[model samples]
Target: MASINVDFSVGQGAISSRLYGAGLEHVGASVYGGFWTGPARPGDESRSAPPVHIGWREDVLTLARALRPGILRWPGGPFSQSYRWRDGVGPRGDRPLRFDHYWAKPEPNHVGTDEFLDLCRWIDAEPAITVNTRSARPEEAAAWVEYCNGSMLTSAGALRLANGQPNPWNARLWSVGSNNWDMGAPEAARRHNLFARAMRGVDPGIELTAIGGNPSNQSEWDKVVIGQTAEQFRHLGVWAFDGVASVEGDNPEDLFHAHVASAERILWTISNAAYRLDEMMLNGGAYVGVDGWGIWKQSRQGLQHDYDMSDALIAATVLHGLHRLAPRVGYAAWGNLVNALGLIQATERACWATPVYHIMKMFRDLHGTEATRCTVAGPAVAAPGGNSPVRSSRPPYKGMALIDASASRDVARGRYTLSVVNRSFSDRHDVEIDVKGLPTGIGATSHLLRAESPFAANSAKEPRAIEPFVFPIGQIPREYPFPAHSVTVLIWEETPGLT
Candidate 1:
């Protein structure tokens, strides 16, 4: 049995709702079959006439809308470094299908800048465009900003007007370049500064995010980039997709324990990096933006993996950790929104939300903006050695709690929400919670995400196999049973009067 104390009077920080954002890359079906699957070309007269061409499938769009994605990054993930924006815009018949050197596939360029923006508009999502700096010059990247956001007086803007878009896309978020360690040139930092200046010159209102450093080691790279581009960028970009897998004849629970601890360590590193920024004395308060996240499973052609319930639980833990980190983490986008390690799997005819999708939706729809401080006193579990999910210089910390939790209070709705993840493999712990500075008699609603087994998953055939089950409690209980390897969210209306 575990007794947890949650103090609503103590506020950790404000949770950034955009932290739950997801990304879309131009690789694999993520674009073609995933987003742009119209019967006719985008600019064709048939697209506007009867039997109009819907670029994105209706069912898929409807499911995505439910997730309420705050921001969507476009046409990237190593593809953007070499991508030529000019090739994707204009009449579909005139646009060229170019060979993608990175993915070694033919890119039809049918869903170009205009198409991407149109999709964003349809979904009501903020556009986070990554500019090509590895293969394109600063002026080329600057032209992209102008085309999307500049007035018709500008050259690229004039082209946009000629192409039929009367108004600017007015995109605010931009990533300077791809990962500098892999594809970036030695002078890429300087080039990023040049790109930032040129793009911002076109529209100073836009927010620029530059590569801070490799996620593995960010100190040196952070210092280098901050020295070069002091105040040009608003956020320093970082990527994380840590996952656990069972080895030969090993227990699966071992992997889940290791994965949760590994995820926490990575978050701590991000927080440390933000603290170090104070010593660098940068101009604006720049936060870490984990724009690329999700397991990078080894594959031949595409990055798609059948995410199990354990994977979904790990993702829930990650989301909880991000929300707990609060104002330090400005935004986080799950890798590939549609097919490449996507939350929702989509075929031409149908789309199915994965277990991870349900978890994300639950957190996004339920969690509030203000993070509250919480404490847990329970029998702690230790992650076994040599079972570390990722290579780390240090071992897992001693006395890591078996139960991980985060809480928030929504002021406008007069509600409070608590997200808790039980990391135990086989042991079901009794959880007793006390909310300081609060009265009783509050009605509570609980949403539980669990399955018969951690390895359980949902496929296209069984989309709701591991969905959430909601129950209403007459009052907030003094104690509850938290099952092993599960994610639970408790929400209640905020009591106005004091006890």
Candidate 2:
């Protein structure tokens, strides 16, 4: 057992709202059945019974709102290149039907561009549209942006107005490619440049995210995309870099650890640059229906790996890396939001948030945009060194702690929140905090998200497995027992008078 001390103070710098740019993609029922299917829609009468009213959409919106998400990436991963905005926009009867490549299902195009924009509006989230970089031309990409953000005078803008949305949909975020590797390198590079140039040419006001390679190949892809785009699109207000998720290994834990390590590497590379790049979109976690590799796995158990505790821990660790390096890593979008490989699973009858969802929600709810310094003098958790049941093949960090902790101070509210997670399987240790440096006269509250049963989880049937509980801390305690396998968030508020 060891003790940790954290010092926090009000600062003038504000945490980037982009830290909250967590997004999801719809491949399976994630969009249509999960978020858009109406009660009146022809389907299983039981599942479709609830009309597709604002209420149903509001449920997912509520979740996104609670997370204070800054942006919602839509429509595709690999599927984006084939997605046509026109097909998904107007009335359902007029929309053309298409086959979904990723999910091998029929895409009715019911949840089109308009619906997605409307969804973003309802949740007050910025829409991050993924254009067809692999298959569509630069003009096509430009048209999508023009339809969304251009004034009603232009051709695409006029089409948008004719579709019933009179006002131009001023969405600021756009992704040039989804999974560029699906296409070869030469073609991918050409497509990436084309979309980048087109997007900039169409709407100089929009922030563009040009696709790089998988995180593993970031150095190579960054050299190409960033280097090439820097010359032409840099002046067009295009900003941000995008990477796909690729963790090498079959074991779930190993895959998780690999992704974490890769995420750390992405942060390091992007942060060390002298000139500030707009943002780096680090895509991590299991892709829907995919196994350890980015391709779909057949085993049902393999498909549900994201629901496991080991995956949850890995997700948390990935988030830890993101939060720890927030200065450099500007944006993070979970590969897919609703279907196939997603945080939320939707059946015709119901939908439930998975373990990854809970973990991300926890991070979103408790952690702030800015990273604070935390020092711990405690026993280190032995790195299983890729042997742990979770199969993380990445080399271990030296002297990693059984207790992982990070802190942030919110200057506006004059408050500090410290998040601590004990990853130990057996050791239950008492913890202490030294917040003497924070501005004084502040009240404090602590919230713990833990379960009496280490294996307890939130399921579709029982969704309350690991929820949050708050405790008041009038005085800083010298010690508090931290149960193994738990995450604790301690909040300190500035009270205004006493030191």
Candidate 3:
């Protein structure tokens, strides 16, 4: 049994809905065979134009809607560095299936600016466009921003009108790619400033995301890029793919636990960057954007990570941590939304929700407006040491608490959501959550996500093998049993009194 104390009064800033962002890039089948597969079916209605319908897979679209993604990033990861916006905006047949430098395959410019914006509109998600800082000039990058958010009088806006978007896209988060190693930090910082100037000059109000490299190599990129161009960007975009650089061994269990345990590294990277930005004091309002995050492994399917329950635990834990961090961490986007490192997998036969999709759907659909601090005192489990999952330079830990948790509340304070994860491989936890300032005997219910083993994965044929189920928590201040290797999300209203 465990006693978890949650103080409603103390925590970080209010949670932004953008914290639950999803990335859509042209890596592998992420665009080609994934979100933008097949031809436009009869019922495919474009919400933006209403008259013009385009390429999209219905099954993938349906799953995306259910995921409740708040923000959508596009173009590429490494592909962003190589993509050109101009090639994609004009006509369909006129668009070429150019040989992409990053993925080393032909990228058909099907789901470009227009289709992507329409997607954001259909799914009710804010648009976050990325500018190609490397290979593409500052002017080209600026024109793309103008094409998305400028007035009718602007040249790019006129071009946009000719291209069928009469209304400005008014896209929110504007990113300048995250591949920062080409020119080194100093040169990259300079180039970032140049692109930022041109893009912001076109639309002064547009928010920008600067490259804040992956956690393993962040030290070389973050402080320099952030310090040199703090005024240029609103969020430091960090690509956090936590797992083995390559799947180290045959034992999936070892890699699974290692993946679960290393999830903390995601939060740590954000926290560390946030602290550095705070220390810099140049950009007081800067937020750390989890530009792309998930487990990185050497799967047979290339970067298309076949996510299992282990990845779900990482997703849930990282989300809870991001919630607790609040405004400090901004725009946490899952790497690619369709195939390569995506939440939902798309194939020619059918599309199905990966285990990560269910976890994301649950947390997003039942997201909290406010964050609160919580402490867990529970049974301990030995954390994996050595380098089975991924090599870690940090010293080995004594043990990890079986239960990891975070607290969230509705804006009105009448309702609260507590997400608890049981990291134990075989032991369920009976935990008592002490919610201070909440009343007694209020009604409560819970959502649980679990399976027989963490290694169990979901595919098109067996999507329901691992999923979330809703149950009634009955009352507040009661001992709840959280299943082993599971995520338990509880929601309750407060009546007057203590637990």
Best lDDT among the predictions, by candidate number: 3
TM-score of each model, paired residue for residue: 0.90, 0.80, 0.91
**How far off is residue 365 in model 1, in Å?**
1.0
Best of the two (1, 3) by TM-score = 3
| Candidate 2 lDDT over residue span 1-499, tens digit each | 5777766643323345554454455555567666666435556455554444642454554555565555677775667778877787766788888887666779887777887787777666677778877667788788888998888899988988988898988888677676666455556667667777778888787666655554355455555555555543321111122111333355433343333333333334344331224432222210011001111222242233224443454456555655665544445665455545566655555556656567666666555556777677787633423332222234554545566677777666565777777665555779876665676566667776666544455666765555666778776668877876666777776753212
Q: Which stretch of 10 consecutive residues in model 2 shows the poorest summed lDDT?
A: 285-294
1-499 per-residue lDDT for model 1 (tens digits): 7777877667888887677778888787887776667655556444442222356666677778788777888877688888999998898889898888888889888888998888787766778999988888989999999999988888999999999997999998999997656643337678888999999888899888878665565777778777777678888787765554433347566655655565565566567667666677545477777778766533526475567777776777788778776767788888877877888887655578888888888888888788888777777767643232343333545666888788887767777888888878777878998877443567778899988887788877887888899888757668888888788998887653211
Q: State, as a TM-score between 0 and 1, how close model 1 is to the true structure.
A: 0.90
| Better by lDDT, candidate 3 or 2 | 3
- Candidate 2 lDDT (Cα, whole model)? 0.58
Residue range 359-431, candidate 3, lDDT tens digits = 8887876656888878888777555533423335332335666688888777464777788888877777888
Candidate 1: lDDT of 413? 73
**Model 3 Cα displacement at 16 (Å)?**
1.2
Q: How far is candidate 1 from the true structure (C-alpha RMSD, Å)?
A: 4.2
Cα RMSDs, all models: 4.2, 6.4, 4.3
lDDT of each: 0.76, 0.58, 0.77
